[model samples]
Target chain A: MSAALHRIDTLAPRAEASGTHIAIAGLTKTYKTRGGSVPSLKPIDLNISKGEFVAIVGPSGCGKSTLLKLVAGLLPATTGTITIGGVKVTQPPDGVGMVFQSPVLLPWRTVRDNVLLQVEMRGRPVAAYREAAARLLHTAGLDGFEERFPWELSGGMQQRAAICRALVHDPEVLLMDEPFGALDAMTREKMNAELQRIWYETRKTVLLITHSIPEAVFLADRVVVMSSRPGSIEAVYDIDLPRPRDLSVMGEGRFVRYTQEIRKHFFAQGDLDH
Target chain B: MTDTLLVQSTRANVLSKLMSMDAIRPLILVAVILVGWDLAVRLLRIPPYLIPAPTLVIEQVIAQWPMLLRETMPTLTATLGGFALSALVGIPLAMLIASSKTVESYLYPLLVFSQSVPKIAVAPLFVVWFGFGVLPKIISAFLLGVFPVVVSTVLAFKSVDKEMIDLARSMRAGGLRTFIRIRLPHALPGIFSGLKVAITLAVVGAVVGEFVGSNSGIGYVLQVANGNFDLPLMFAALFVLSMMGVILFMALDAIEHFLIPWHASRRPDPNSGT
Candidate 1:
């Protein structure tokens, strides 16, 4: 397995020069529940390039999230290895950031103070990051709401603040697990565009997990589809499209075709046309 | 949408609210209570020793101001001293328990046991151990006050959202950083609740110690007054005790407000704030 992964590492020098950020080799995960040890993700290998926005999509209960967690080091990989920035991930990397599906901002903290939390926790001076945090908040369209508590904001606004918090630390890798899944459809689309813009502006590598086929097609440079329960990589589809894509692109034929192709792999080989 | 009408209506609403803020209902209720008390005292002619009239208690309080102040000093000292000690010890212990499950499990039952013991009954032991000096009263106050602090600190510590901790970890925050930045701030309200309850109990505990054995304090005055059948003086001492409790509690509350201006409990009601 090491020899096989070494071949991939040999490919890494060429890719590294071209900016490859994370490389996963035969990554597998299992959970030791009360009943028994249950496998979550089957052994699978994949690589996410630097500055790339990749989305993992599958049905509910699929291990797409598990894959993200494994890479994030929230959980340990049972029988495989994950490398970020050419280093094996044994724990949550210092340069990795995560955004959950829920806007998990501390309710007691004001919006600005909440963003500064990451910096403060890192023992970094808040003075150094204060302007940067403010800038990020403004980028998320939360300019004047810095002093507002989480409860004072609407759901969409709170989630936006959460995103700002994730980016405030300026991590090399951003792991997002259905960050906009809880938002309304209109807000979700808006948030998606905002996220894309942020990703483009920051040029940070992002690994987003979602169950939405269209969402995957819209945001990802490549869409990695997984099978349900005991999940493994079914296929990886490269979304060959232009940068800074508009929401109107979804109405175009190419977008629909990519979404259809991804959906076909997500469902079992059956009446996929239906 | 019309500017003039909107401004006029808003102003009218504010004016109407202000007008209704008069304490008519509360004043009437106080008046009715006083009348009922006076009527009950006059008709039933209950012993002044058992249930002294409000008038007599007030007169006693005014006349015995010099003696009361002399008593107030010692009692207030023990209450404040014990409360301060509890805050210092209990908060850190709460932090320790909150940070570790092992600490919580081991100490939680002991904390419960500490509160379960009848505080008044244990006052004599404090006197025996510490002598009939201020030490016993202070220890009594400390014992009573510490429980609320521990309970509150534990509650505050536990109430910190798991998501926030994860957020901090993903941001590369170390354990100490997480506590200072996230957990401690999250636990403030609960800690304050404990502090408030502890302050009130501190007075009770101090008095209990005085009751058992003391050369000074309002509790000693009460005992002496009771022996001589000086009902009015006893009532005055009791009134002073109640006033001291109120004053201490308010002082703590004020400190809380000053320290954590953003606390929800500290925020005045928007509708009621004049």
Candidate 2:
């Protein structure tokens, strides 16, 4: 087999092939405004298997983030349905964790308390999850800063706290919309490594939406490419790169080739799309 | 070296405390204004009744301290009572309006309409309904103050990022849980700003209520001073009333500081974190 498979049908066999975790069938979105209804997403179909990491890459205004919101059940689809963990998702489903581009942590809360917010919001006993919150913060390299406020930490640290908040409830599905998009280049690369380590330990099903081609190639088991404006899936590439990936892996030939392959789509469309 | 360090640090501390922009700038401006007013009144030979010198006002405060103290108590009670009432009721009302379309549609317009009707006009109505007791003054204060708290709180609750609410929903947090954990805390800074405005307005409301009808309070003292044509006493009452307004505003500011030190407005202290 070639290093990356572009065909949707010719994909390799996997543990989750028999059972799709997050199934999106003909999902679409149209926003209503005073002017008229504007199409945001064309009918899109994709399947993310349990414990698999998938990253959707597209140019700005492509609605890749919309797709993630749809799967997370934060938004109602214009057409079709989404299923997560064998249940139809009408409202925001349980056992799902989401992180946005901004940290979105409460300013009044300490880092530890912000993480425990997930547990507290779920009506769970906060005392029980204290250790879990502490461990998650520790893993995120924020052990000593648990009592600190979100503003006291750097941008990367705040996002780390937000990630920990997402996982504190022990949600099986982790949906991220450009989680490290706000960080500087160096910090983003480090966060990518940190995310990989966290994912390695937890093995949660993750659907990350991003514009960076290399970020998509580096983190995902499969990279789904999206079109601009009324976005639809353009191509899917299976990443055959070795896991337990690090910052150094980004420099490898395989990783560079995958990113270049994805970048080719935007270049073909227009330079302005990137 | 130690002695020099101590001296340098002490000088720095004094300079910062005396010259800092936070509180000292405003204090300096007030001092300038008072001195300029004193000079202008003496130079121009402005009559005491038109604008008494600051010195005469200070002397009036000292001479009639007992009477002023007696009147101040009632106004303070009414202001605090009305402010507390508005906060207790207004926050929940804001949450209701934010969460429900039905409440927003019916109640929001009515609230806006209520604001359009002047509080001075409503003060007489409150006095007529409740008689000349402190209840009328409190109701007047509540009428003037509640709108800001509700409006600010509503805007604050609505301004919370849609993603934050989604994150809560995905965690299986119900409506109340989403509000308590996410919405309420996020809305605090806005609510506090509204409270600060409301507190000052509450003082004005109490005075207005007394102007319309009242036996006690600083407003009554002003009315008596007006009848007597004792300009210094009038200036003293005005001075005391303004001081009370500042004190109430500062009280809310202090509360805001204690509650949300993590907020950007409260984090200007450079030596806060290590």
lDDT of each: 0.83, 0.87
Candidate 2's C-alpha runs over 4 A off are: A1-19, A30-43, B1-17, B21-31, B118-129, B270-274
Clashing pairs in 2: none
B184, model 2: CA deviation in Å? 1.1
TM-score of chain A of each: 0.91, 0.95
- What clash count does candidate 2 reach? 0
Name the TM-score of chain A in model 2: 0.95
TM-score of 2: 0.89
The DockQ assigned to candidate 2 is: 0.70
Please report, as a residue range, the 10-residue window in candidate 1 chain A with the lowest summed lDDT: A1-10
Model 1 over residues A107-213: C-alpha lDDT tens digits?
A: 77899998887788777888999999999999999989999888788888998898888888789898999998888889889888888999989988999998778
Give per-model TM-scores.
0.86, 0.89
Q: For candidate 1, what is the DockQ? A: 0.46
For model 2, residues A178-197, the per-residue Cα lDDT tens digits are 99888998999889989999
Residues B44-68 of candidate 1: C-alpha lDDT, one tens digit per residue:
9978988778788789999999989
Give candidate 1 regions above 4 Å deviation: A1-19, A124-131, A264-274, B1-32, B267-274
